[model samples]
Target: MSKDDDTTQYDGAAGGWGSVRGMLSTFREEADSPAVLRTLMRQNKPGGFMCTSCAWTKPAHPHPFEFCENGAKATLWELTSHRCTPDFFAAHTVGELKGWTDHDLERQGRLTHPMRYDAASDRYLPCSWEDAFEEIGAELAALDPRTAVFYASGHASLETAYLYALFARLYGHNNLPDSSNMCHETTSVALKAVIGAPVGTVAPDDFGQCDAIFFFGQNTGSNSPRFLHTLQECARRGVRIVTFNPVREKGLEVFVNPQHPHEMLTGDGTRISCQYHQVTAGGDIAAMLGLCKHLIAEDDRLRADGRPGVLDHGFIAEHTIGFAEFAAMARNTTWEAIEAASGLARAALLDAAGVYMAAERTIGIYGMGLTQHVHGFENVAGFVNLLLLKGNIGRPGAGISPVRGHSNVQGQRTVGITEKPELAPMDKYRELFGFEPPGETGMNTVDACEGILAGRVKAFVGLGGNFLRAIPEQAAMEQAWTALRLTVQIATKLNRSHLINGRVAFLLPCRGRAEEDVQESGPQTVTMEDSLSRIHGSFSTHEPASPHLLSELAIVAGLAKATLPPNPKVRWDDWTADYAAVRDLIEATYPDQFKDFNKRVFTPGGFHRRNTARDRIWKTGSGKAVFTTPTMLSATSIADAPGRYRLITLRSNDQFNTTIYGYSDRLRGIEGRRNVLLINPRDIERAGLADGQVVALESDAGDGTHREVAGLMVTPFDLPDGCLAGYYPELNPLVPLWLHDIHSKTPASKAVPVRIRS
Candidate 1:
């Protein structure tokens, strides 16, 4: 590969020398302290801070290096010496800063002081914390509770989330929308309806007990590289691995363990997946229907021959309902529709089904790929249907695992950062805090943006996130953001969202997870819950980025104290001084889930939260796991037209959710740019376009909106003919705010209809 060429073929295994180079380069470029490597060694250990990257679990018997490449990058990125101080803000105006790129804005580094946007000067000037809080309090007090939106991100800890949730409820309404509403809300919605639990059922040790593992829509190498170690161990033990994704991922094919001496010395890696099927975008339901149909048909044949069939008939009869209706729908779905929708032959699905039938125990893992679509709820139900057929639930080595992003995302939701009225304990809140809670449901992410645009929402408060940059309709939302009367952002670093100011905006700097947090209680540790429902304490030994920075706990407490009149039931000062007071409140609210929360969280390896679904006890109205049927084979029904393709928004190996680490996507062999479009070679030839030609993409939503992005370089890759891939936030404009899942309201970022023009 040369500097002129932006794309190249990466033939090496994922997580060998390539990962080593990536980690070292990040450290060399970002680290200010010579002891950064020693700091990295403490990550995920018993008394160390949790890696702030993903929700991947730590092993009971930990290895010397438990962290992954992304974890190292997150640590170094947080601990960088570069500072976005008051001087930097003083030099740049809001209009001038908006012209800069997202990467460059964050590259200016950690925000050191609290700043307020000045309309006259059009620049952010430093302000005292008390004055800033007082102004926000006055603005919020003047507005109706229903008109204010309180948003939270996945980065907040359990203690902070618990306090934040209470703060909003105490003020008035439940307009609490968090990051979970965007990514895995589909999984939570569908799983709760079918299995009576909103979270996954598998534990870490289940990987070793399963005879086979099925992966859907998840990219293990980039999103959660720590999972690659488990996959490598399973592959070495002859566990059959099957994968279904739109793009062929290297992490699922093979992985080289950097920690293993033999592999690092000899450059030998273990072969991972036995079968990989490239399912088309929005085709997961059809593919899953194909698998279910095959297994049911095979069972009928075996039962007629008077032998034991593959279906778990006894389990179905004893513990499930709606089996006949669900099976009928699966059988009614024709193979032709499945083939066209999934872009896979009947033989491929049959082969994967055969692996599932032969195994006594299996685990299914998925990521945002299946959940960020219009019919994402149906896609999740399809996965549960496959697992239910073999009695895979509530058994050893068999369950569903929704690999999540952000360390405490699931934990935040567990502690109650939701918009639904039923999910919150309104009566308990009244009893505990001596206030009557609002009974009406509140706004989600999509609804919040619509509210802001419609002038119904007057204020916005963000705990920690780039809300404008992470959502769809980026240009429209950024423009509409100025309509709000107040905007308060509590953050550690400067992102593009800081530039999109409202009439009165305040940016309050907070402590990062990698920095030590000391309260009146001396030292404090926050808790995080992984994808497996295990709770653990996380603490850092490093100094704060700035001496003026406050903890997230203190910031939330301060805001609550300033906003509302003093109430006898609430003790904001006491809770802020000691986090255990907050934990005691949490345990009292969800007694079964967080019993003895403070004592158990600090112990080695932490504790596992109770999930009744793991014990075959469904918490639904039926008291048993239910089955669901899918009505549609595809998510969208755009008229088939020439040059039409489904555009999938992707994250590079150098990127996290909305944070761009660098310009290079090392795993895909792309360098120095992110404005390149990945298209099939056949599609490029059919469209009469050359490999390196500049092209544009126009979205087709049938809503009379003209959405197009130009100046994209076309690069040929191996994929289905009518599918294209590009990075997110860059491609967010092509998706409309109204295009989302009907049930979950999650923006459909995975599948957008578009046409390519050269």
Candidate 2:
């Protein structure tokens, strides 16, 4: 465990006393305030509000302290004592605030009231909620509804997102964009096409039954700490864990279950990953294909032995189609091609294949690493193909697990927040609302930016999220925002997006997950669906962070009322009075699955929602699981330009998405800085660069669009050759708007071709 020049020591294990120390510091600095402590104490507890961190599922039987380090940070962030009132905005001009980093803007704390940009003074001034709504309504009503872009964040509850989508459609537009369009759209695209569902089918309980688990491209420790407990349990039970990623994540190496006091105090933790391999950037597809090839060869060998071969022929024949074509393609694949692309020795893949062959049941866990490439959809297919060959789907202890971001990203999609509205859902809407929904496909995140730059999008409405910060091609996105006639953000706190104004800009403060939302009917509770498809209610016991702030659901209702004319079928007032009314509508729309939605969601641990894939029922044109034959590409195929290195954007251990909790990445041992790029030692030497040397990165965007970020300190680390990693938002510029996956349209953030210079 040697320390790099930047003091980034190779972390042997994740989460010991250091995690406890970070938790305590977060409590003191961010959550020690009166309201914050009261709210934090009740958060993630039974019957309390769900933590607004990553969508890691909660245990059915919760302990007293159910939160983790990042979870606590998210809670403190939402319930922080600091407030940004009118006076704070009045003192700082937009020009001055524009220079501030995203970390500094959010650290100032919760937004207390609605505000509007005062063009005359270049500062934001307090505006009444009523006047703010009226101004937005007037602007939106004046513009062509098709030109209005509606953006959604995963921070909102199912009720809020469902309501927001309904309002946007009722306003006569379906330009709905969401965070998933950037992160997991590829997973959705692949899953829907292959398995007939947009979500995962595996529940947390299945971890206990799994014999082997494959970590395709996920950092479970930092992104999802609670899941590590299950990993530790599997480790104790002698389950095999194989990881395929470009970075040597500490979590995948070893982990200390914080729930276990012995491991926390003694610094002795369960060793998690039995075997770890670093794939080249965008190399997951090749690595997975290599594994599949080895499995096929092993099956052929066992079949010759007159024994039970690894191939589940019975299941494949009865439950799937097109396998013969896939097997032919997989057998034709060469070992040299896979080794060169995956950056792993043939022996390693063969060893991992042996482990897979020995196990009776297995699961493949993946994150953005597998889904943020040009062939991301194909990468997903590769993993699923391996599992399908072994009969993993629709069985206990097996299936695809997409570790999702945002507490309710899955829930929002389930409640019908989508750009591609289908005919069936449209029919349901017409039956309920007495109006026909839009028929054409709408803009996604990247498409919305295209709409903006083309001068087709006039007004932008965001439910919650730092849209301006999260998107790729930041410089272009900012230009697009400036050209828009109107921009409105409904959010809990102030962010840099508010400063990236349009011709007219307004900020509507709303209640966060940790605050109570009192409605006309009574104190209301909202539901959040976890990554496992469990729908559960979350009620905040603490009072609102500020009385001036309204609930997100209420904001959506208010916007609907202010903008849309009354319809006898759609009752905005009734939906706002009681959230249950919204649930009723959702259940009535998706009756087969969401039947008794309100009652089921309130059940202890929340009832698991039905996914057709879980029952081995394929709703596709094939009427069965369809094997996909994808042409495998080189790992660095996207980095085609000469002297170009593939840049993979990442979030530090201290950060979540664009929210900077602090300047440290505990697992990587980085401290007090975000202006550094991680590079392989040999790669740095080849580029004629020394450790700690300042350098610049230039995008391979041959298009007229210029993209680069300079003044970054280079630090040598263990990584795939010709591949570099850096924190996101800083490196997002290198990913041009035009560079994306052709299938899913997701930003190819993981493998943007870039040149490093002195």
TM-score of each model, in listed order: 0.98, 0.98
User: What value does the lDDT take at residue 230 in candidate 2?
Assistant: 79
Q: Estimate the TM-score for candidate 2.
A: 0.98
Write model 1 residue lDDT over 284-392, tens digit each, in one string: 9999999999999999899999999999999888878878999998888889999998889999999999999999999999988899999999888889999999999
lDDT of 1: 0.88
Tens-digit lDDT track of model 2 for 98-189: 99888889988899989898888999999898898888888888888889988999888888888888888888877888998999999888
Clashes of each: 0, 0
